[model samples]
Target: MNESSVKPSEQLSRTLAAGSPLIYVVTWEEERLEQMLARASQELFGDDRPVWQWTAALGFTSGPGADRQLLDPVEALSFVVSESVDAICLMKDLPALFESRPALVRALRDVYDHLSVRPGSMVVSHPSINIPPGLSKEVYLLELPLPDADELRGMLGSLNSGFGEEQRVSDEWLDRVSYATQGLSSNETRDLFHQLVSEKIVDVDAALAEINLAKAQLLMKENCLEVITKKYDIDKIGGLSKLKSWVISRQKLFTKEAQAARIDVPAGILMMGVSGCGKSLAAKTIPSVWGLPLIRLDMNKIMSGGWGAPEVAWERAIRAAENAAPVVLWIDEIENSFGFLNDSATSGNMTIFSSFLTWMQEKPANVFVAATANRIEILPPEMIRKGRFDQLFFVDLPEAPARIDILRIHILGQGGDPEEFDLNHLAKVMNGWTAAEIEQMVRAARIDAFTDGREITYDDLIHNIYRIVPLSKTMSEQLNALRIWSHNRATKAH
Candidate 1:
């Protein structure tokens, strides 16, 4: 909702007529809510009348006099019962109380019963919905979203108060701040702005960086979401001819051109293959290659306890990605996250997983996803099913010709002369080794030569190769099984 032009009095009128006596305003910014309520009270009841409110520690009191009591939610509820026609019992952290105390539940029921007969109501404000079954029928919930550009501008104007009445923060600065604070609440936005001012870093870019850091922490707390700038260009990654061609073909689909052409950019790609074959690299690189921002989702972070549902966190992550549209979302090693969604034991987690699955399946066509998995066997079949990914590609170990290119690329990258090395001998020696193993061997050889204070030689690399056991030797059976699985199912990257 646009909070810029929304006057407190108008919002109060809407709250008053809402059918449910218990109105829950889900928002992270308590100060904004407080300011709105205070302004509404001044308009409706006038400064002369007392408005009794309560809080836990302070028992009960009236009007602004009850500010201390209102800080403790139980007292606030008690105060609502004791006074004021059309009064509001504003409770904070009421959701937490609902889980811990059945007495609070009964007390709330009693309060609801009284409010049904009387002319007043009780209101709970939280960052998210956590309605217990007992309070579900009694409470009406409304999620208050983050502050829009106009509201942020107003806040910025107020923050820069002494800058002059006619001129305040510039529209350009406001635009930057608005974008930086996309997923944050009014309180978060205000706090970040104030923090920048307090630190005396008045430059807008510094403030934007500070906000970005805070946003990173907030998204990290969710575990499954990350905000990252794409770092690698597609040209830098070698030897995925077919996959590269496929991705290049859809390049326009991720741009405004595709939007005008009414082409659905496609949801995402599923990269299935043996480990260390560039699945992860490809996923991370797509955002950069396609000129989209990248967000890496690590499912390990989503299982924590919090103020809201885990599903809400998933939705928030997905929404943030979509909000940053024309963005690439990289869900690396995704099989672990969705592997058990089919199991009844992980139903809650499964439910959350399915929500993500649905989004990936039906997300706005512009939000491209690039998910990578090492083990296709563990992934829920539905995920790899044709339509989920525009295409599925198998990233096998580098073939003979690809190995030569990969070695040359790595050697050149390390300031070594590619012409100095015996490429044919190295490729032959590295047979059955994964690209990752070849890279590792080159690193080991470099270190071996450095230890002896000598330049690396072909002999050093051969020695390194012999020293380490490659996956081809260790997991031959499994690799063969996997190759069979991918034979007809996926497009080969070779």
Candidate 2:
């Protein structure tokens, strides 16, 4: 099934209408899920088929036994079975009880049996999926996705209409604000919009920045995925003409017209080659070029078990990245992270590896993955294959021309005039230098000139060029092997 094309509400309504005796919805947005359930209930079963909500704090909040104190899980299931009304019962705070209370599990199974043949359905909602073995077969899982752009846009419009014209933002700003709130829940989105209106911060740039800041904070709580705030312009990066052109050509695919035409979104490219050769910089630049948010996945954290088991933590991180759709997910030094894909891989590592391959192949179109690797030889063949990544480009050591471009950029960036230096001569002298090395050379030269109380001169840069040794010389054997590997396997980025 094309999960991306189908709306969550439609999926829920279908499941409920198909007489799924018990449904397990995994999501943190209980309020939003309830709203969807209420609407789905009315449409699927008419006004008479009421929607009931139950929580440990307020059992039977809305239903036949309004405000009834059936805090016990077994008792709650008993009440639902005894009532047996044609209704939708939303049971919150019940997943955690499955393991500790076997009686509650058996009771839920009974409720399932009772509701299977009837018009009623029991929905268990929780922030995560944790079904005990006994009731696994009886539960149908449905994950509630984060709010999409259209939904968020409608929400922004609804909130904006409540304010005076003087405080209102333009439709363009509304679109931007909606995109900015991609990863937030409905309640959080509403609260953010409320804050914006209350504070009268209707300026487009400032409001969007505030929204992104809030989103980054919330997403960071997951511990594995980080929202990258530092922006890099694609134009700032030197050379890689082919890769840059390819990226630019696909920018149209993200446009409204391209979406209307139903063009496939680019899966993303894999950049494999020397370290410090601008692979990571290219990953950071893509989001800025496309006007999308950038998220970095910390593989080390996933393996650390700080969030949970590696598999569980991986799922959480992937879900968070997908939630922030129309975003770039940068996975840097992927080979080092998934090194277990080698013969030494454990059963757990193999599971994660297989799952990652499948996810890369089938991930949502909006979640563009810009992954970089310093050791492509360590990665399994299946990972770098065609379908997994749209293209694999080898980022080699900067050629003389690219070295000159890198030098010029870093020079201008450091408040020095590139024209003052003999770039071609410097590029030659720093032969085989990585982009990162060149950047450092320029920085060191600027410091030298500053200490000497003069503007940066060509001699300042020349002095550092002789002082620093490039990675191409230090790791010549590895660099040669990488070049040979990419000759027949990947396209050249330069």
Best by lDDT: 2
Clashes of 2: 0
* Model 1 Cα shift for residue 198 (angstroms): 8.1
Per residue, candidate 2 scores C-alpha lDDT tens digits across 298-382 of 9888887888999999998998888767678899988777754345566666778788899998898878999999889888889
Worst 10 residues of 1 by lDDT: 48-57
lDDT of each: 0.69, 0.85
Return the top candidate by TM-score. Answer: 2
> What is every candidate's alpha-carbon RMSD to the true fold?
6.7, 3.3
> For candidate 1, lDDT tens digit of each residue in 73-176?
54555545665456655666677667666667766776787788766567777776888778888877665555554576677767777555444556566655
Write down the TM-score of every candidate: 0.66, 0.87
lDDT of 2 at 343: 56
Reference-based lDDT, residue 322, model 2: 82
Q: Candidate 1: where are CA atoms >4 Å away?
A: 1-16, 35-83, 86-89, 93-121, 127-135, 146-177, 193-212, 219-236, 241-266, 286-332, 335-369, 377-380, 399-405, 412-433, 462-494
So what's the TM-score on candidate 1? 0.66
- How big is the positional error of residue 461 in model 1, measured in Å on the Cα after superposition? 3.7
